[model samples]
Target: MAMRFSENADRMDVRYVAGLARIALSDAEAARLQGQLDDILAFVGELKKLDVSGVEVTDVATEAQNAWRADVPIAGLEREATLANAPLARHGQFVVPKVIE
Candidate 1:
């Protein structure tokens, strides 16, 4: 858990996070956000008063980690055998549309 960022997460942090999330908060929004963040920090502080001494941590998911076989190098399919299933190929690679364009 991060301590209160009020001392460090200034307008710069809010702005940087907003930029990464593609948000465009106005002056009022940023000011409101600062207050909201402060309240959230205070609430988190309140939770620290709990006594969870014997609590056992748990995995929240039903899925289990897949255990693999021994580390011996297994033979893989040949390049032509694998590429045979691709819808289209160029230079022995899958030819998807250029995403950045």
Candidate 2:
């Protein structure tokens, strides 16, 4: 039988999260997302119940570490060349409309 999350979902908390994320969600969307989030949490809870005493805890399966390339200074485009295509330029820099007062 499939687990029902409609009863388990916290509607208010889901709305709070949506608000914090600066997203606009309708009542229908909120209800749908609440169920989905509840379902994910329930799945994680179920996974926590599994016994893994003998299993090795690892963040990654491969032995290879993060490979990084040496940072070398390379000549880039000149200041005038970069500002040439700007819609507005001030003091040799691109000028954009102020968003925050």
Candidate 3:
């Protein structure tokens, strides 16, 4: 069953979440997104009402195995060649503009 929520409650919750996430939203945008989020939550709530007592649960959904290659050491670019592309380099390292005081 879909859960019902008040418009005021939805607006408040969505606005709070948007604020915490540092997202700027106008009143119209917040109202629109609030309705969308509410619909999603309602659908999830409906799914929770399903009877899955006989269903088997597994960690993975697919039978595919890990296709990762074996770790093997390979030749890498020389330090001189690597540093040649750096816009700024100091003491054998790339020098970036100071971001923090």
Candidate 4:
């Protein structure tokens, strides 16, 4: 099945991946990556069917949570330091380069 699918990787069904990712992979690159992806998927398919009769399921193998100090107000950067790299500023807001037409 893997070999057959890889050999016929030219079908447009595979190209939809590039469109969804906003990429323009060339024919060679797409074909190459398609084969790799198919192989990975096939391996995962095999893994999914494994029988783990005694294994435990957890959200994560090593569960952890965030630890941090309490949030509190403190002194902040001085105005000179805050505007050091800004091209323009009005009031206290740093102006940014125009990104819209």
Candidate 5:
């Protein structure tokens, strides 16, 4: 079933959305955002009215495939080379400050 964006606009609360997103919005900001949200819903509603029944469904817009090269195992830098530029290294590993108590 197709979802109706316009019908859900009335139920969309800007303050509620902001709270869920952990954002603090003033009364004026909420009002502004609410209007913008309504406009977006109206636009989506217009899009829902388009005739797309004849269009073929595709996962990607382009025909390109296997975009990435084969991942082959190769020798990495030696331990000494890898830790040469580190601020602190001991026992063939980086020594960073304690992050947790």
Candidate 6:
């Protein structure tokens, strides 16, 4: 169900929202939070009254294109040179401890 807020209507129920969130709020805390939430909803109500017919919808703020480079194959390090610093090497490959039975 959609929840709406307006000056003429009853303010949002903080206790209901708290219950949905699985939170336990004391009466005093619920009252305080209710006032804060009401103010936020009122601000949103004000924003809904604004006219933005001339504004353009945009996905990004900047005009820059994708910064990715083309993928290409290149020569890699020699196996012998790479295994030189290995603690264990076998059959031109690094040997690691067995992790599973």
Which candidate has the top score in lDDT? Answer: 6
Give each model's whole-structure lDDT. Answer: 0.69, 0.76, 0.77, 0.70, 0.78, 0.81
* Maximum-TM-score candidate: 2
lDDT rank, highest first?
A: 6, 5, 3, 2, 4, 1
lDDT tens digits by residue: candidate 1, 1-101? 21333444432345555766768889899788867866877677676688878887687665667767887898898889888989888897887767586
* TM-score versus the correct structure, for each prediction: 0.41, 0.50, 0.48, 0.45, 0.49, 0.42
Q: Residue 75 CA error for candidate 4 (Å)?
A: 8.7
Q: Summarize candidate 5's per-residue lDDT along 1-101 as a digit string, tens digits.
A: 22333454544677777776768988899899989987877777787788999998789988899889788989999988999999999998899989589
Candidate 6 Cα outliers beyond 4 Å, as residue runs: 1-10, 52-101
User: What TM-score would candidate 4 get against the native?
Assistant: 0.45
Q: Please give, for residues 1-101, the per-residue lDDT of candidate 4 as tens digits.
A: 01233433433345676776668889998888878876767666676678878788767656567657788989999998998888898788898777589
lDDT of 6: 0.81
Each prediction's total of clashing residue pairs, residues at least 3 apart in sequence or on different chains, is 0, 0, 0, 0, 0, 0
What is the RMSD, in Å, between candidate 6 and the native fold over all Cα?
12.8
Error of 3 at 30 (Å): 1.4
* Model 5 residue 25 lDDT score: 88
lDDT of 5 at 10: 45
Candidate 6 residue-wise lDDT, 31-62, digit = tens = 89999988987877786678978889789989
Pairs in clash, predicted candidate 2: none
lDDT: worst 10-residue window of model 4: 1-10
Better of 1 and 3 by lDDT: 3
Q: Candidate 6 — which pairs collide?
A: none
